[model samples]
Target: MSKITNLLAGLGGAIALNVIHESLKKKSKETPRVDLLGEEALQKTVEYFGGEIEDEKTLYKATLAGDILSNAMYYSMIGNGAPQHLWLRAISYGVAAGVGAITLPEPLGLDPEPVAKTKTSQALTVGYYVAGALVTAGILRAVARKKE
Candidate 1:
């Protein structure tokens, strides 16, 4: 892929991830729901660095920005040269992000505990990330087929 195509691929992945993630969060009431990876990441990151957010609005915006940036980076990472197995890629992405999602917050004092409260919740939590990756891969594949 050309550089522009590569960049568009990343953006496509980001859009797919965000849309799926948000939708799953809204639709699923399963125990270990992931409501705010970006928000938690931002909060924990700031706290880890010993910074304070001035207010809720600022924090909210920062969280959204963080989420967008993360999706771009992650999808770009996968699209740049990762394997072609979308399911495998999704599992890997889910595991890596899932671990960080659960572990990073409390150590940084951002939350009382990991967001997932039970086993099913935990699985579903990771599943959402996998679903996002699937969405990304599906979008990329569809576009490629359309081009052909």
Candidate 2:
């Protein structure tokens, strides 16, 4: 795939993931608060560098931007190989990221409860990632077909 196409597909997936997460968070307390985790990490990183945001809103915006960029880059890996494996790559990347979100926080000194509080929370977290991946794969396939 062309680099532009790959980046666009990845960006779409990341946006989709955040859209589902933000929507669910508004209606359900059980929804994962990945934002909180991101905020915490950002705060620590800032402090580590002797910098402080000191404003909640600014911190949140920064974290959200960072999340989109990082997630897009990570999801872009799905375009690394043959188009035939696009779905597989999407599922694999989504599941891995979902599982990692739930499992990695504690070890990394961040709170895990935001995503792993209960079975429902965990399941929903994974579902959001899968939804994002499916969106990405669908977009990629559509573009590929257009090219063919």
Candidate 3:
């Protein structure tokens, strides 16, 4: 029971942290744009490879491709808007929760055995959350650089 409680606490903490990080990212205003020229270049390359885009459809296709790639790049960099980030954040919180469950102590009025176990769990859980945060931030930074 103590383990479960500890795990829950750790997970909760991680989730809160992720939310804060996302808010910070949004506050910074990382904007995303569609690169029409890039799409045109890609279309030309495809044509060179014997895949021709008819003139009437070329503009439409280029715009569609540009929008897709631009959105992908934007989402990857601005993870606050990406579903993958939410999933990752959840996983990170779960890990922290599991650790907390094992290491964190229960409340002062609670049993000592549970408390000790919770403490151990929490220690590991916090570590996992920290690692997750670093990894997420690094990924976002890499995506931003790619856009540049």
TM-score of each: 0.69, 0.96, 0.26
Please, what are the lDDT tens digits per residue for candidate 3 over residues 20-97? Answer: 433442232221111222344456666779996667566656655454443233223324445446446545544553
- Model 2 TM: 0.96
lDDT (tens digit, per residue) of candidate 2 on 33-132? 8888889989989999999999999999999999999988888778879888899999998999999988999998988988899898999888888888
TM-score ranking from best candidate downward: 2, 1, 3
Model 2 superposed RMSD (Cα) = 0.9
Candidate 1: C-alpha lDDT: 0.61
Candidate 1 runs further than 4 Å off: 21-37, 47-51, 82-87, 104-114
Query: Which one wins on TM-score?
Result: 2
CA shift of 114, model 1, Å: 5.0
Clashes of 1: 1
Q: How far is 65's C-alpha from truth in model 3 (Å)?
A: 31
Name the candidate that leads on lDDT. 2
